[model samples]
Target: MDSQLHIFFFPYMAHSHMMPAIEMAKLFASRGCKASIVSTPANAPHIHKAIESGTNLGLEIGVLSIRFPTQEVGLPEGCENANSLTSLEMMNKFFTAVNMLDQPLEQLLMEHRPSCLVADLFFPWATDVSAKFGIPRLVFHGFSFFALCALASLLRHEPHKQVSSDSEPFVIPNLPDEIKITRNQLPDYMKEETEFSGFLKKLDESELNSYGIIVNSYYELEPAYADHYRNVLGMKAWHVGPTFLCNEEKEGYKAVRGQEASISEQECSNWLDSKKSNSVIYVCFGSLANFVDSQLMEIAMGLEASGKQFIWVVKKGKHEEGVKEEWLPEGFEKRMEGKGLIVRGWAPQLLILQHQAVGAFVTHCGWNSTLESVCAGVPMVTWPVSAEQFYNEKLVTQVLGIGVGVGAKKWARLTGDSVNREAIEKAVNLIMEGKEAEEMRSRSKALGVMASRAVQEGGSSYEDLTALIEDLRLQRHCCGSK
Candidate 1:
């Protein structure tokens, strides 16, 4: 194995995607492989921090900056990531800007001629670019094997299409787990034909043609789905994940953008120290999730009614002005002053979750957050919003038995019926005080221990990563000999 083997990573502009990819790059660097991450200028700052941490450990990880075509795509300056966008129409423009990078990305690949290129699944054309240089392209889906299997099964069977109404629940066929999902719970693109559907179809085709797929999940978490993906899908794949946990000892390894904890470590610790062990609930949606006023009010009321100590993250949004005055119940903050803490921008999620005071999580079921919860040994009250999240909910509650859903049957918007205070209260109570909560807590702790062990020396995820690096080194030697 040559120390000169270079692996380049290209993550999508979103925080959820970029965070894991950056961690993957760091892991490669720690193993003495020359690693680099490609990003737009706006995203470069976040990557720089991670690279700097690796450098301190005597690992060489570089950041390659490509200009994001903001003006060309009609996006405002600094509107690079998905969280900056305001509307669905703006998302198309963001993709347009991302696709414009193809030319620049190709030029970089030609110049560097890295041993392998790891790219996000959204870029279907990356396979062609890698082929031009004869480099292997590993598509990083940034999700678990279970969600991937469920989505693939849904697309193949089209079970949602067979249902008459959006509320009708149907069992997904040909899966290792018996999972039930309603039509409305499906991604919007699957519900009706949209532009995203076309993009997803193309992405799926490119995945089959690419070198192999890399997932941010471990074998112990979902062995059945991982095996199904290999035997049934016939795809070359590797499961080296809970990537964030790989570099726990490295200081300054925080999430890019909105994931950083707003409260100081000392301050957060002081607050958590006041609560009893496993007595507090932590609530946060991912960076991109935005809720309507009605929904926000319901969540606030529900948390209040649960009569538990909690920490909730409320992100800033266009329609979020005057939320305290208009959306919340009268004197809500005053009433719950000592009982809860509301973080406005970013919450130190990893630190908070690892604290002994934290008991459960109310999450949107995003892959990164879900994995973090699993690693921290916290039970979850699932409330999936969009984009394969409902599938993830099934994995958490039905398969793993570490969570319970909030009875959100559909992806709600400002116009839809809010999940209501009653449902949120019930879910919170179930995870906090009910008899089932104890079983969930025990299972969560067991999974957490396995997750930690999997990333250590001689563990499943550790071996998979070692195999991946060695495979690349062998490929480089074989190619150079020619």
Candidate 2:
């Protein structure tokens, strides 16, 4: 194996999953390595954009397609294409499909004969695939270290013992940080002894104990978790992240719409452009979070009463038909005609957040979204909707002190499913106009600068990336003696 080499990368089949892998791929390719982005055919359209961007920029990057079972075991024909499913459900199906992928992945490895395989944590067979070819395997956890640490902790417990509803913080053993979380905040599968829990636990144990684990977080923000993985867990792990900064050259690039017009990207920029500087409250719950009728109504009423200019990017079909403005106060849209911008489909999130007019983010607190918010130097109102989002909320509100949460503890709703209009107004007002908001804004901006520095030439994340490559080089050399 050569230090200057080709590598294969597999991102789990989701936009959030794909973006992080693409970010890392760009980084590796820019560093004189060729990268083949191994993914399913369904993810081609979205990932093709990323692949094209990397290759056209003169980085050696290519797309390698994987096969999906003709009949999905637990989903509809086009379930993978639909963005409506919850992240937990998505992961459940995705991990189940991993068994089907082994053949295709193995074939690609034999054909490409890459130096290493850098794959998403969902795919347990990546380590086996690397070993078969005598190559190093780097398992990338495309999330914050906190979530990775949580997953590692979840793996140590028996499947039957994991679902206990004790009203106490389940402390993660052997971690440097006392990041204690309640049972309610655990991954959805671990909350109960369902089929999903048993299957997921098996996958975690197999992958978590791999030769190396790579997390999408910088050392400074998660020094404790990073240190734990390296020291206590005694695993070869790398924290090369604040991943967006991996390519400053690609910062200005936008997604080019080719064929699938399912997601529209029109006038979203103009809408953000019209809002007041640092005055618009941008709300998006990522691609997966779906709200029930009552929750939807409550959120609408809240945004209406807040009286601040807002850009609410509602997902398509999130709520029932005829409930768009019907759920809000009468004439609310008319009242805030120039002030409110409701983009119902995909909006350019990074561009919108990075805009000068966008002030506070009313977010679902997904790790990728959380990191993007922090990197954009925007303070947040963390309205965590599901899964590991609650833990992310804890990190933002408690550990980082850079955002406000909608709940008191893990999974506790600030208001019931149907929050009254007044509570919404107050939450928005607090984040947008209060002294606390300004303090968070200042701290978030400072952290953004630090995050940027972390990926720079001599920065923490940069050195980590360099170290990972150097270690792989050493591992390859050592293998010759065997």
Best by TM-score: 1
Query: Would you estimate the TM-scores of all the predictions?
Result: 0.95, 0.88
Stretches of candidate 1 above 4 Å error?
Answer: 1-3, 53-56, 252-260, 317-324, 412-417
For residues 96-158, write the lDDT of model 1, one tens digit per residue.
Answer: 888888899999999999999999998889999999988999999987899888888888889
lDDT of 2 by residue, 1-482 (tens): 34577778887777777787887888888778888898877777678776665244678888888767636657555555435355556655755665678789989899888877888777777788778879788887676777766566666753325535645666666555566667655554666578867667656765655668877888877677777667776667887787766654463454331123233445667776766789998888877775554665677778877778888876655445755544455676688788887766666677777788989998888888898888888988887766568767777887788887665344532221234556667778888886888998988888888889999999998898888877766776787668
Q: What is the alpha-carbon lDDT for the whole of candidate 2?
A: 0.72
Model 1 Cα shift for residue 13 (angstroms): 0.5
Q: What is the lDDT of residue 144 in candidate 2?
A: 77
How much is the lDDT of residue 172 in candidate 1? 89
Candidate 2 segments exceeding 4 Å error? 1-3, 54-56, 72-95, 157-180, 248-266, 318-329, 408-421
